[model samples]
Each structure stands twice: as structure tokens, then as C-alpha cells.
Target: MNNTTHLPVNPYLPAPLALPLSLVPGKTYSQVMARLLNKLFGPELADGELDFLEGKIMRVDVVDAKLHFSITLSQGVLAAADTKCPHDLSIEGSIYDFLLLATRREDADTLFFNRRLRLGGDTELGLYVKNFLDALELDDRIGPFLQMMNGATTLIGRIPRLAIPKLPFPKLGRRS
Candidate 1:
């Protein structure tokens, strides 16, 4: 069974919008995710620690979003790979599953073993990716931001509903 079969589309992004989301160019995904990846592993990337990933195409599939992108590192930079090239590794899951993994709300073993996240293609590549993620300096990089977000969410949750007011708007239409 597909992990995404019974999983709901992310609340923040509707399923019907998958088509539009998939329409985003591969170049855009490559650039954005590459920059984010570089930032997240700045020291390692700069030290040639990720040179092993060079020329290895890895495909990420956001299942519910119906979006996929293939990328490879080249000259120490991530770049969109030619779609015709076979991916060395493939990972698929719903958006929320990915979020859970990223936020450490759920461990990778749990998600992968539960079938909430799927991996295919080369087993070695999978191991490499998992090891890389494991070695991330998360606390050193994004700890402060996560703390701020957590504080903000806590404060926002305590706000009373009445603190927000809804206003009505009049609609204009053709008139005789």
C-alpha cells in the first residue's frame, strides 16, 4: 500500500493544488532546496564532505503534492539533474511526514518502518543520505529559530478568540 494512500494532503496545501505545485520548474526546486541544504550543512559542504554525492542523482517525491524533483551535486553545488537520468535514490512521502522528520517530531526509523515514508533505488545512497542527516548540526544552526517559533506558537495559542475580529465585506455585482 502506498504511504500517501490514506494520508491527507497537508492542511496548509490542498490536494487539488498538486497540479499547480508540480508545475513549478525543476530549476526552482533545485535552487531553493540546494541553497537550503548548503545553509543547513555549510561546514560539511564547504569541507568537501559531501563530495560523495557528486554525480549521484537523488529524487524526492512529495507524494500528496504530486511533485518530484531530481538533483545532484556538481562542483560542490546542488543542481537539477536531467530528468532522463536514472536517480541513484528515491524517497517518497506525504508533506506532513517529511515535516515530522525535519522537526524531529518523529524519528526516521519510525516513519520509514511504519511505511509513512518510502525509500527505493540504491541502498547505499539511502544510507549516505541518512548518515548525512544524522550528522547535521541542527542545534547549532536552527535551534534559536525553533525556540522562537515554539515561543510564538505558545503565546499565540493562549490568545483569546475574541482578540481577533472578523469584518464583513460587501460584494459588487452588475446592476441594471
Candidate 2:
């Protein structure tokens, strides 16, 4: 008799999903991060939500992407440094985990408990930053833009992995 018995797959478990390429090749992490910060922190600055970071240096490391960058608020403006600096706090996590946090798909505590996110340097400062982010309502802050980007991302990920030659114009007259 066979020793193994078939078991049903757990439907509650997350299925593996392919993520579409988003980062541009050859672009330095700082450059990409600068663009992202300009979008994410610009509003926060205007709203005075980032006042606490005015004179603090914070470093964020994207482990899987092998990217590291430092952030500072100078005169209420968010700045990004290419190299690591003497940071008051540091946050480290994989790009996927960071994205989950940004999108409110997961909480910082949950990620921390699971060991997917980490904090170092000044614990108090790190906790302050974490609390600030947790309190901030991202959905209300960048609702439409985030939704559009998320939709586009999902659509791109769902596209078939087909390698077809690029054409300048569509074949308007043909059904195929």
C-alpha cells in the first residue's frame, strides 16, 4: 500500500505571483529613491507631518534589491543621500516587505514580528518613525494616484509572457 496520502492545498495561503519589472536598469538607487521621496514626502512636508524629521538622518536598506539610501529633512525639505550617513535610525527590509508596508497591506509590527523588517541605531527614533508612519493615512493622502499605479502594476503583472516583435503601428484593418 502507498504510504503517502494526498492532501488538499490550503486556499488561505497566498499564491505565488510574478511582479512586473518597475525599476529602470543602470539607474542608481539614490536617483530612484529621490524621485520616490519627492512624490511620497512632498505632501507630508506641506502638511507639516514630517516636522520631527527636520534634523534627523534616517537610512533605509532594501535588502533584496541591494540598495541603501539616507534621508534627511533640511529646512523642511526631504533630501536623499547616495551613501550611508551617520543616521539616528535605520530601517531594513526586502523590497516586497517595504511595498507591503507602503500599501498598508501589512503592518510594521506584523513584519517586525515575522522578522521580515528590522530596525537599528537609535531605537527610540526608529519607533517614533514607525509610529508616525502607522498613524499616517496613506490611502487618504495619495488615494487616486496610488490606486492608478497599483491597477497598472496589477495589469502588467497579469500580461502573458509573450515575446512578440515590436511594431510601430497596429494592424488597424486586420482582426488579428
Candidate 3:
């Protein structure tokens, strides 16, 4: 559990998008996730072990002109990984819907039972990751990463808050 107070400039990749200054938001899964885990848990990985896993886990296979992600989780660490990429969970729905579901962990199992999360591959892996991810509170870890991806500020200056738009609520006004 090594924590990094400052984000080092890793020359191997472009610095992730900054935060707090007004920037567009969209990121490839790998770029956003890699920088995130590096900053939050850089101490957790001493070498390229995580990166190797990154290539191993965060991958999409293409066959017959179709593409799908083949994710593998190493049990227990799933929670930590999810905290870093809450938006990228492989739930059964549009990416936006999945992100919305991710922000609402209390309803995750409900969604899963409702057939809203189309899971594939190892069930045990899914359960392990889901439980671990379910238990985590990752606002602190995710905030900087989101900010960095949004391109406003960086690890420097004040850490920006993770600003996910509030989900729209059902209309309850009296029927006309």
C-alpha cells in the first residue's frame, strides 16, 4: 500500500489529460487506467508486473470482425483495480449506463440480476473482482485520475474533485 503524493513524469507515455481548467473528457481504457493505478498504487507494483497484467487483463479480442474485451482479475485486487477505473466495468449495457451503474454500487447486484450486466468468462473471477470492487471507497484515488484525464490540471496544483454528472431522477411532478 504505497501512496504517491506527487505524480512523476513517466517518459514512456504522454502525461495523462489534466484537470480543473476546462477540458473535454474521453479516454481509451488503457491510458486512463494505467496512469491511474500508477499514481494511486505505484508503490503496489514494483516493476512491470502490473503492466504485464494490464496487457493481459485490459484487452479486447477481435474475431469475425467483432470485438470484445477479455478481462482477467487476480482476485482480491479487483476492488483496488475497480476503484481506479469505475467507468470501465464490463456491465451489460451501453458504456454510459455501465458507468452510471458503477457509481451506484449498492445497486450492482440488482443490475446484475436484472440482466443489465452481460458478464462473460470466469464466473469466479467476476465474483472475486465484484466483491472487492464492491467493498472499496475510491473517491480519493479516482479524483486525481479523472481530473488528469479531463485535461484541466495535473497532480500539481490543488487536486480536483471527480465530477461525474448526477444521474437524472425520475419526474415526480403532479400529472397535469
Candidate 4:
């Protein structure tokens, strides 16, 4: 006689991405993040989430006359430096959040206004970095990573929906 046993399902366990959830911005952000990390960090560094940043940092310190970027990684941190314009940036929110929001080209103005994102160091530097990230098309390099991610999600019987958050316009009177 043969006996077959079935495993019980747990709802708490993240549901599979099979149904292709609604068009949510968070998903788009995730994809961009994967691309940036793959391009900037490399494949070897793709161990875990925080692992990508370990011991890696390139600080813009300052860029242009109105921007400043403080790039920090698990490897190192770089602060944008500028003399003409000064910026007061605080590193409070999750770096993951900043990275995600920064990838959405042409969304910085809205991002800053809605406070969906924040910057550390010079404001101009941050803007410049945002612009740079927007122009970068990590697709060629990021495709494989994204494929792997989607494959893994699919293997578990789920569908992934690609979406990026909609940033709000910045408030007036704030330094650009």
C-alpha cells in the first residue's frame, strides 16, 4: 500500500505572486533597486538585501551648485561636497527607501514634496544623483537579476507585477 501526505498551507506565509497584484509602485521600485545593485555592486555582492551595501560607498559630497549626494554602502559612504550651496541632509529613513525612490527618473520634485523620500547632504547633490540614476538604463545588466527574481517568485506559484510608486510634487519655497 502507498500513502501520500499533503502539507498544510499557511496564510501568514507571503502569498505567491501568481495573480499579478494590482499595478503598485512599490514593485517598480523593487525592480530598479535590483538593477542599481547589480550594476553598482556586481553579482558577487548580491547575497542579501543589506549585503549589497556592505563596505561600499561613494559620496557625491557635492555636485553642481544646488545638489549633494551622500552615497553609503555596507562597504563605505561618500558625501557630496560643495561650497556655493550648503545642504542639511539627515540620514533617518531606510537607505533602501532612498535607493528605491531615487531610481524613479523625473520623480524627485514630487518625491521631495510628498516627503515620500528624504535626502542627506546638499540638496543639489541629491537632485543630481537622482537625475543620474534616472538616465542610467541598467536593463541589460539588470535583466538577468530581474529574471531570477521573477523566476523564484514564479517557482513558488506567484506572479509579479512591475510598478513604481507615483511621487508627489514638491512644495513651493523649498530649495530645489
Candidate 2: segments with Cα more than 4 A from true spot:
1-28, 144-176
Tens digits of per-residue lDDT for model 3, 1-176: 86855532211111243222113222333445445455564444453333324322433221211223333334313222322333333433433224434455225676566554566544654565567457556667677655444342222213333457999999899988
For model 3, which pairs clash?
Answer: 17-148, 18-151, 18-152, 18-153, 19-152, 19-153, 21-152, 79-132, 92-117, 92-118
Error of 4 at 113 (Å): 2.1
Largest TM-score belongs to which candidate?
Answer: 1
Ordered by lDDT, highest first, the candidates read 1, 2, 3, 4
Residues 61-171, candidate 4: write the lDDT tens digits. Answer: 211112223333434322222323333333222222343333332255554565445566556545545565555555566677656554543343332223468999887
TM-score-wise, the better of 2 and 4 is 2
lDDT of 2 by residue, 1-176 (tens): 88985532211111133122224231355556766776876767788877778778888876545557787777777777535457887888765567667767679998887767899888888887888889876676678877875664354334444456987996569566
Clashes of each: 0, 0, 10, 33
Residue 156, model 2, lDDT: 38
Regions of model 4 farther than 4 Å from truth: 1-106, 147-176
Instruction: Give TM per candidate.
Output: 0.70, 0.62, 0.39, 0.32
Ranking 2 against 4 by lDDT, winner: 2
Ranking by TM-score: 1, 2, 3, 4
